[model samples]
Structure formats: structure tokens, C-alpha cells
Target: MDVAGAPRRFTGQYYEQGRDIFTDVDQNTFKAVGEEPVSTFSIDVDTASYGFVRASLNRNVLPTPDAVRTEEMVNYFRYKYPAPASREQPFSTTVNVFPSPWTEGRKLVRVGIKGYELPSASLPRANLVFLIDTSGSMNAPNKLPLVKQSMLMLLGRLDADDHVAIVTYAGNAGTALPPTPVREKARIAAVIETLGAGGSTAGAEGIRQAYELAAQNLDPDGVNRVILATDGDFNVGITNSEELKGYVEREREKGVLLSVLGFGMGNYNDALMQTLAQNGNGNAAYIDTINEARKTLLDEATSTLFPIAKDVKIQVEFNPATVAEYRLIGYETRMLKREDFENDKVDAGDVGSGQAVTALYEIVPVGGPRAFGERRYGTRITEAARGNDTEYGFVKIRYKRLDSPTSRLLSTPIDRTKEVASFDSAPRDARFATAVASFAELLRGGRYTGSMTYDDVLKILGKTRGDDAFGYRSEFDQLVRRAKTASSMARLGS
Candidate 1:
């Protein structure tokens, strides 16, 4: 245990700050469009980073730069993009380019993808295993109790066709409730309410048992998932990340997906949870409040439970004649090698029903200020090779159906025709998403957010705050105010 008196796994070293376990990779750097014209990365739908940042700001502390993944922050909110017309494609992509709000002479390109939405009555039956961590570390109100309430919210959304099981891990792993139909809500709630937190965390053991239960009660034509709710402190058994990941990988091959629901703040192993969820071909979400829980499990139940596309990847080829330098705004960790984009065996991110994923890129058009210094020697595009003045880049997406081995391809050309004259003239969703991305960059040290301040972000957000049906945008406004106050306090302390 650290100074906070919270129970933590006995790792090699004991840091006084128990929250030191949170980990993230370095950010992406600008790439010259002349040298590397193609940008490829897997689509990510995880919303944990945004929730984690919100949790930190709510506590009056600034989140670490690593904790702020700008892409995840932007994708957390639902955008009003049109869904695909048919399940044959599963998703539709929309691209828009507008003047960059942060950089003076550059342009911001937004790529949006919306997965097909299935009616609630049309959703397939589900076999869900709740892997709850009842270790001593989860003794707080924000951990075990919150998890119970969140599970209850999910239970309310499930129907008679769904089957539920509960497994808890402490010093040992055991089944709290056997595979029971959703119609037995009273019995399920009873089992959940009886759960109490204590003992060490055998997360790996719990996972193995949950997978066994999930496989035993598998739904051949429906969703089979293990939802692990924990603070991500795994110890007592199979503590090595590689070993745990290997176990998850093997289980995922049997058609049992895994999604992680993170709770608590101190000692949260975000990196491990992300790795497990990614390897298991599922999504990860951080549950900070009951409202967030409802948003994840109830409001977005179809998307949260039913995946429409798997291993989705986007590769954009920028025309060197139109753009001189480019950099993907976020998704540093989701970057894929050019070769991996064509390799179907390579695992990527998944898109669920009605889920919308977005990616942004900052580009310096030819004759504009280059992100990096000019290349001493490079092949120049001639007038003929430059193609027409209307085209900007080609966007290609590859994804495999949930049950297919081969991947299908979709392509579209982004052109000057789609470019809006100014940021203010852009679509409301695009403008608001850009503001969110800018705010995220500001929170992550603002190295690239030139001349952009908190007030500037607030103003942009205020203008673009459309009809927020669920009040998510309003919550974002409150977070911005909190961040402003937090920044002021930090400056004073410094």
C-alpha cells in the first residue's frame, strides 16, 4: 500500500504515488508528404482516455500528458454522421477539410466513419460474462459499488434472449452466478448485491474462468463477450502481461471477445487493460460516474454489445502536389505499418453497431510553411503527374465482416470540392470535434496548438455546441471550466 492507504499489488518497487502505473506511448511526429505520402492506422473506439481525463480534472488535478489521447477524446462523443445504407459495407466514411483553427496556414482534414445501426429488436442474443474484481483494491465507492450499479444498468437493457453470468476474483476466483437468463433479473441482482471486496486480485485466474464459462455458454450466432470490470491490478496468479495477453489471444480465437471496464483511479493499470482489450478484439471504457455507465451500457447498448466490423483500418494517400507535409493528429499507438494495412492476419480495431469513429490530420499545403525543414533532395511532381486541381488525396478503408476471413475494401477520393472556406463555415459536428481535438492537445502540453488558449477552445466549443440531446456537450463545457480553474491553480502553485 502507498501513502493513500489504498491496497495495491506488491510489485517490485513501491512508489509513494500509487497512480504511477498509468502508461502511454509517445506522440506521433510530423511526416513530410513528399517522403511518406501514405498514412495508415487502425480505427480505435476506446473511450477510456477521455473518462480518465475527466476523472483527473474532476479531482482538481491536471492529467498527465500521456493520459490524454486526443483521438480517443474526440471519438468519445457521438457525431451525427450518416450510417451505412447496407450491411454489405457495414460502415460509411465521410471526409471534410477546413482551415486549421490552431495553425494559421495549414488545413485540418477530418475523416468520419459510422457503423451500421441495428434496431434493438433485431440485435442478436448475447452471452455475457461479468468478470468482476473483488480484490481489496476495489473497496472504494467508485470501484466495486460503482461497478455493481453499472452492471445493473446493463442488465436493464438486456432481454430474455440474453444469458448472464457473474464471476468474481479475489485471492481466488469463483462464480457468483451461473449462466442465467436475463429474465431472472432478480436473481442476478441478488448475486451482484451479495458481492463484497477483499483479498488479493487474481485477475488472470478470473479471466481464465470467465472465458471457460463464456465458452461453455457460447452463443453461436450472437455476441459472446467477457466484460472485465476492475482497477486493473492483477496479481497472485499469471501476473505477467505477455502471459495474460497470450491467454486472451488464444481465447479470442474461440470466438469469445473481451471488453474491459475500468474503475477507480489510484493504481489503475491502464496500459495493461488497453493491451488486453486490444489483443482480445474488444473495446475498453473507463467508468467514472453512473451517467458515464449509462452512456456506455444503456444509451449505446447496441453498439456496446454488437460488433459490425472487425479489423478496420484506414489508409490515406496525400497528394504531394497538393500537400507538402502532414501529420495524423492523434492515434500514435494505433499507427500501422503500410504492409500491415493489406495483411488480413494482422489484428486491428473493431467497430460496433451505430458507433462513429473519427480521425483528424493536419496538413501544410504546397507552398505553405512545412512542418519540418525542406528536404535537401526529392523528386518533384510535374504538371502532368499532379493530376487535376480538384483532387487532394485518396482514402481507402479495409475491414472484415464479423465472421469472414477475407477483408473487403472501400475507397473514396477527398478533393478541394469538399473543403470549406473557413472553420466557422464547416459542419457543426466537424467544428465541435475540431474544438475537442484542440482542447485535448492543449491538455497534452499544447506543443502543436499554436496561439490556442483555453478561452479560445471555450469560444469555439460554445459556437459549435449543437443540440446536445444527451448533455454530453454540456458536460464538456463544464470540464473546460474545470480545466481552466485547474490550470490557474497549477500556475499559482508553480
Candidate 2:
């Protein structure tokens, strides 16, 4: 879809196979239309916008799906570093950025991969098994072959003592290599090169073997995970969701985590990947190309592998006296019941070392002139609550030690007047979060107030464009202009 009169290049470089997938839509605009005007095409994912270009083929060819999801795309955005929690010899810094939201007809959206620092002291010895899909379906350049290259990039990030393993699935799953030290790069590289497509996918068996290796080589005080690289189409044995989920759950009890790293497109099963990741006590990501593999493995390696906090659940109790209604943005799927917060069995999000997660709630005033109508009328408040009618809500965080069951609680209050005006007035990190929320609102049709249009979003982003440190904020400004122009042209065409 053309947003601007023509597509304009942003901060990041674009790549294509023989430049066949991309086409000039208008002036500076370009879209990936595929060979022979087909629907599907090879794609490279990045930290921005999931590196996906959606469009149609001109003739009879079916357009292939781009596997990247925007959630992971937004997560890939660069973040400004913050002061480490410890002060005595701990790292700390203050970051500030200038606002650069969209303007006139341009649209800018800011998504943050929030500032996270990996302290050498807190780094863990890792045991990682890369379970790859070598089925015929992975013949696409963006599939199995790309998986090998991506794993190679990740291999470079491993320390000498770290253990790496390899497993493959097709007609059957087997250990391509046992857990080996990272220093043995030559052997690892050789195994990767030997992989090729042939049989049907046996994802379940592959996972089972991978977990067994991880358990045998488990790093009790370190990161132990199986990184499954696939197109997410699990055929063969244990293909059904219930059985697959059950397997992961049982293995997780053995303290072996799973990181579902999806590759390629066509028949991409987002639901399956999401389910496995959530159940496996890990995160799921889609890699559209090699560069994305670098970002996930190199730049954000710590967050993807090691968990600083586990089962981290957030509970905010709204004060009936101070607030009428509140709706959390973006985390609808992450929400927990009031009782679930106290239940240790229920799983929640994991926060990596130095990783910062920000959540926002847009609330309507209670008993005020600007209320969004009554949601509750003189209803008796539940006994399972905590508040003294002094603020909007109590923000409570519950987390567990990576291996422990008992949880810890951290509570903070939302003082009413300490409102963050525009993106500029907030901390660099908070501003970044504001941009993400704004963008998500726009994408979801802005169900709540402040679902600003593309122009408005750009305005917010432009004003908060912090130091072009990672060039992420700068790229956002460019996206704004492109979006504005495309939106306008679309309107005129209609």
C-alpha cells in the first residue's frame, strides 16, 4: 500500500534477492511485489516495522506472506541506556532526546526496544541447542539456509565456555551435534553446512531431543534453552496443539526453556509459535532475514537468552474513588485475574537483566465532567483489594527468582498530578514508550481516546526524537513522512 506519493528510504538499508521482489509504485515509493507479480517474496526483518512490505501481485501469482510480526518489529527498536540499579560501582546514565513527531502531512511512529545493559558480572554461562527445520519446505532462501547463517551470527556472540548444541527435524529428529563449547567454531560451522532439505517436519521429536540435551548439559545457574528455528508449520508427529503444549510444559519443569525463533513465510502459524513460546517459558520472534538474526543474537542477546526475573506479573488496582474506568493498552493478552497475580502457578512475562518493560493505561475520570459514562454503578468493591483512596491505582509487580516458586512484590503509586505531558517532557525511555503506545493505538483503530491519526502520531514522535544515537528515532521520522504521503494519496484515490 502506497502511503506517500512515492516510497522513501529510511535509516536502515534494504536488501532483495536479485532486486526481484521490489517494485517502484510511484515517485519514490517501492513495494515488494515478488517475481512475476506473485504475492509471496523473500523478506528481511529488522528492528523497525517488522521489516515487512505488504502488497498484491499484478497477475495470477499468489503473494507469499511475510512472517515478521510488528510486535517483534517494535521490540527490535533501539533504546537509550539507563542507570544500572546498583550505585556502588554500578553503571548509570541519564538520556534525553528532542521531540520530532509527524508534521503537516508526514506521519511518524516511535516504537522502543527500551534501554537494556548487560553487566558482565551478571552474564550467565549458556547451554543453547539450535533445533533447525531441514524439511523440503525450508528450501526457500529465507528458510532453512537462512537459519544456518543466522545461527552462525549467533555463534559469534557466545563466550568460550558457553555450550552450543544442534538438532534437526525432517523425517525424524536427531542430535546433529552434542553440546559443544563456543570456542569450537570450526566444528559447529561444519555441522551447519552439512544441513539440507529432504524429509517432512518432525517438530515434536526435534524439540524432545533438544530438551533432553539441554537437561543433560543444564546450566543450573545459567541460561539453558532450545532455540527452535522453523517456518512454524509443524506436521509429522505430535502436530496437535494440546500434545505439543503438554510436552513443552513437562520439559519446562526440568528447567529447560525454549526460544521459538521463526523463519521464512507461507503457511506461517503465528498462533502456534506464540503458544509454544508462552508455554515453553520463552519468547517467540520471526526473522525475515540475516540482519535480524544479528540483532537478536548480538545486540539483544542477553535479553533473549537469560532471564533476570521470571514469572513477572503486573497488577494495578484502580481506586474507585479516584478513577472511574481504565483500560490497559497492548497487553490485553498479558492481563491476569486479580487472584492470578497471587497464584504462583500462573506464568507471566520474563524480564531479562537490565531489560525495562513499560505499560500504559488510559483512564477516564471518575465522577468528573469528562467521564466516559458509568462502567460500575455503586457496585460493592471486592475484598481482595488494596488502597486507601489516595491515588489512581497501586502498581504492583510480582516476580520470582529464576528457579524459585515464592514471588516478590514491588509496589509504586501513580500520583495524579505527575502527569507526563508530551513525549519530550518524559524521560527518554518513557517518551519512547509513549511513541509505541501511540503507534499501537493507530494500528488497532484507536479504540480509546487519543487514537491520533498518522499525522498526529508523527507530531508526537518528531517532538520526542532523542539523540539519533541508534538512528532509530531518526528512522521513525522518515516513516512518518512516507506514511503521511501514502495516506494522502490513498484518500485522493478514493
Candidate 3:
């Protein structure tokens, strides 16, 4: 788990200088349903946390607690939710409650959202700018070289109508390839292959130039986006986070989206990359290997590129009659004020085509033991005061169209009747997601995981890993085993 040993696994030699940055945020705590019945937060589709954890474990290192986001880990795997029947709604919802595997008398409620799918033939033309970082820090094989390989995988899916451009930054930013049609595949491939790594990183300049090119050769009715591939080592210019965020916000108003593809590890600036991607109306993902590249760029190409809805936010109201205390599993970074949910100006996450986003809440029902503490004494509803025995809570979602400014609202009731008799009886996807979420909690100090151990996680994952076509679920199982071993060794060493 030592940092000094990491580079040896990937390369024989190691560099002593690298600046990786992450933000420290407080984790969510339990809430009394009687006092605060409503929980509001924005949707997050970023998968970087999962990839970063995988990279650290592969190097025999345990990821830092701050690096883990439980929600991202849960959403990394696809859930078998029903897709939306029409584009008018853009997404569908599936809600279910099951007995908690980790805690007795507690329940886990899952909210699943699946976006509408559009076939590749029906997908709009793409106007993409590949913003690459070719800095000295990216000299390793996993940095710039892997970026080239990842881009090539994406090229295989592009059509004749799609256009691509390449932009790189080091001491300065410049164009490596002008806007070219996808029909000129050989030319694009040649340009990508010739890219090399050197010089200091000027990430700000690269971002500006890439946005300019995307705007200049804009496809008015197509998917206009800039994909930034980097280790996120921005040393040269505009290092101030607020300044960079403002710049990205302005460009986002110009109808250009920015999706970040992170590479390498030692000097990765995850906080900065995440900020840019979130404010620039895009999703951020870390590409640690060629297989991850294929998963991001090819298998989930539609979800990665074609966004069906923007500013997606979710809010849940727990009935005091049915619940005592509840806590959201993760999404600490995406928490929003109650009023922000109704405010159209407040920016939030985007839902891409055919993507599934899941959220889990741990709830203690009325008369159940208080997991955190005694509930606040207030006006209590009697059985006669409760409206319906079947209704648990209400869920509301608000989102805007890709081109619209105003937002529309969707509301549904979460029924207690949908609760399964046991965790073993829950759908495979729900059980598998819970397993991943629990695993994350354990890695991040196990604050809310109760009695869940690494062995329990493995058992749950092994039993519920249903139909993993690409072996992502299987890979996750291996990761848990590796993490268990690393954690045990660390404890023994201490």
C-alpha cells in the first residue's frame, strides 16, 4: 500500500515529483424523518471514483478514504431497469425496498432511473474536439499512449457525418489536428498516433482553445462536445479554481458540452477535473486501461455522448408515519438546498441516453430501534392520522430538455407494498448495487455499514452477479478480494 511501490508495478523507473489533488468533504449523517421529511440532491453520473479505486487496488494500495464516493461506486454497474417508452419523458423510474443485509430491522430503498435509448443510426452527428494533455508528467505508458489507444476505439464508432478535431496542451496549447470528417479515418488515426508527451502542463489554455474550435465548427443540430484526456496536472496558467470554473460556465452557455477522460495517476487532479466537468455540463470518467476505454467509449457510447436530459435533480419526502430516521448512502457532493430543486437556474447533473442512475436510502421504520439516536420529539401522527398504509413516501424529479431553459417535473409515490420479503428475494440488480454500496462504505471507514464485513460483501456479490456480459461484475468481485487482502495487511503492519 506504499506510494513508493506503485510505479514499480507499472514501470521500472519512478519519478519523485507529482501533484495529485482531492477535496475533503463531510459525509452525510442520519436525519429524523419527523423533523426533516424531505431529502433533496442532484444526480451524478461520474464514474471516476470507481476507476480510481480500481487503479489503487491494482497497485496493491488502498485508496484514500477521501477518494471514495459510495454513490459513484453503486452507479458504475448497469441495472436492469425498464427504459422509457418515449423521448417525451426521457427517463423511467423503478423503486423498491428490501431488508437491509448489514443491519437488522432496517430497510434499503433504491431509486433507479433509466434514460431513453436511441439507436446509433438515429443518433445525431457529433462535432467532437479531443483535448489531450501531452505534458512531461504524461510520459508514462498509461498516460498519453493510452489516451491514443482510447481515442482510436472511439473512432471505430463514428460515422461519415461525424467530425473530429485534436487539441493538446503542455507549456502552451495548440491544434494537433484541424476539424476533419470521420470519413477521413486514416488521416485522423495518423494524427493521433503522432502525438507525444513533453513540456509543462497548460490545461487552461487547452480548454479555451478546444472550446473555440468546437464553437467554430459547430454542428447546430448535433452533439457538440469536447473530450479532455489528461492526468489533470494543470501547472502553467489559470490555476485558480474559481477562474477556471467561470470560464467553463461561460463556454457551456455557448452550447458546447465538455466531458473529461482522465488518464495516468501520480499527478491526477481529480478535484479540478470534476469541477470543470460538472460546471461545463458534462460527465467525468477516469480511463485506467484499454478495457475501461472500450467500456466508456464504445459499450456506453450513447450514454457518454448523447444526453437526453440536463439538470436532473431528485427529491424524496419521507412520511413520518412510515419512517423514523433515514440517511442517504452517498452523493455528499451533489447535495442541494430544498429551494434549489425548483430553481431552474441552478445547474445539476445530466442523464445520457440509456444510462441508469441509482440512489439508495437506509431507513428505520416507525417503532423500529433508532439507529443513530432517539427521534426528535414533535407532533406524532397516530395510525388514524396516517393517510395510507401502502404509501411509504413520495419521489419527485425535475429536469430540462437538452435545448430548453425551463424545467419539467415528474412525481410518483413510493409504495411500501413493493417491499420484498427478504434481501435474497430482491431483484439481482438491486442486490448487486447494494453489495457495491456496502463495499464502498467499508473501504471508507465503514461509518454506516454496521455489521457488514468484506466476507459478507463477497457473498452478496457472488450470489447476485447476474448476467455480467462484459465481466464488470466479475471484475468487481476480484477487486473486493484484493481490497480485503490489502486492508488486512495494512492492519497487521500497523
Q: Among these predicted structures, which one has the highest TM-score?
A: 1
Query: For residues 42-67, could you state the per-residue lDDT of candidate 1 as single tens digits?
Result: 99999999999899889888777777
**Cα error of candidate 3 at position 38, Å:** 0.9
| Candidate order (TM-score) | 1, 3, 2
Top lDDT model: 1
TM-score: model 3 vs. ground truth: 0.94
The residue-by-residue lDDT of candidate 2 on 1-494, one tens digit each, is: 11111122212122122111222111111111111111111111122224332111111122222222323334545455443555221222232222223222111222121223457776889999999989877888888888888898889888989999999999899999999998999999899989998777788889889999999999888888999988766667777666787889899888888888876644455446666787888876667656667767777788778776677766655565555554444433344566787888887766565554444444443443332334344555444322545455555666686657888765556554444445456665556555655554444334443436767666667666766665656665665455445442321101
- Please estimate how well model 1 matches the true structure, expressed as its whole-model Cα lDDT: 0.88
Better TM-score candidate (1, 3):
1
RMSD of 3: 4.9
The lDDT, on a scale of 0 to 1, for candidate 2 is 0.58
Model 3 C-alpha lDDT versus the unseen true structure: 0.87
Candidate number that wins on lDDT, 1 or 3: 1
User: Which regions of candidate 3 fall more than 4 Å away from where they truly are?
Assistant: 1-18, 380-385, 489-494
Q: Please, what is the TM-score per model? A: 0.95, 0.75, 0.94
